[model samples]
Target: MATIGRFVVSVVGAGEGHNGRRTAAVARALAFISALIAFAIAGLMIFDAVRVVNEPIEPDQVDFRLVTGVMLVIMAAIVAPLGVLNLIGARLLGRRKPRGRTSVLTGSLLGAVVAFMVGADAPVVVWVSVIVLFIVTAVAAALPGTKRWVRGAPSPSESGELVLGGVG
Candidate 1:
């Protein structure tokens, strides 16, 4: 079941610090990439929203136009912040600080939700890109090293256990 979920880390062994560091690096890279995609999507959506807002009113279609504009605006609003947060979080993660986990997780989850909502309406290429980015972002977050970092555990390299009897 855990394996089916895609995010669960089941691999176990010694010397995971190096593996974790590599995994975190991958996640950071993916987060940065996804952030760029989110920004582009947000910009396009905002443009569409603005166009809808400025379009001439049609008595019969006013409700539909308004609803469409509102939803577009809402999606843009959500996407822009997610992009910004992911960018910042990824930067921090690269610096070996796990504090950005919350931001990364939030942005990824929200982006995934938005992608699902707009998939049918978006172009095939855009839809596929969004899905791929979402999966990559998720995988990064679920990596074993990332989990350990986020949980505030000291990796073996940083644990200073090599000194014998508490002496240098």
Candidate 2:
């Protein structure tokens, strides 16, 4: 049990003292990439849904087409919001705000949930990629390094003195 706890802590990078700035940068990048990928996927889903809806359907196939198109639209709706959340999180992280980490983490978890919910409908590769991306993003945001960085810790400078009084 203790070993498990230790491993979990290490995985989350708790206790600080690591290369926070770099870790935060990595987290920010991951979030942005995840957002872009999600947006792309959502756009594709929407396009496909529109195509399905516009297709000339036989009388017997009308229900099937409508159901499929609606499901696609619903999935796209779910995915797009997560992408927006991730985008917002990335922007906030760029500005060095602590809430950015929370936003990224939240977005990641929600995205994972959405991926799982729609797993059967999506291709294996697509769902797997989404899951992996969200998990990595969440882990990055949860890292102690990212936490420290987002909290605005001073970086080590050449003389080890905190630099103050810069641009107005």
Best model number under TM-score:
2
> TM-score for all predictions?
0.68, 0.76
Candidate 1's C-alpha runs over 4 A off are 1-19, 56-64, 148-168
Top candidate by lDDT: 2
Cα error, candidate 2, residue 117 (Å): 1.2
Residue pair clashes in candidate 1 = none
Q: Compute the lDDT for candidate 1.
A: 0.74
Model 2 lDDT per residue over 1-168, tens place: 999987755655554465577777778899999899889989999899989888886876435777889989998998999999999999988777877888999998898888788766778987898899899999888887888777764443643666677422
lDDT of each: 0.74, 0.83
Clashes of 1: 0
RMSD for each of the candidates: 7.2, 5.5
Per-residue lDDT tens digits of candidate 1, residues 66-109?
Answer: 78889998888878888998898888786666667666777787
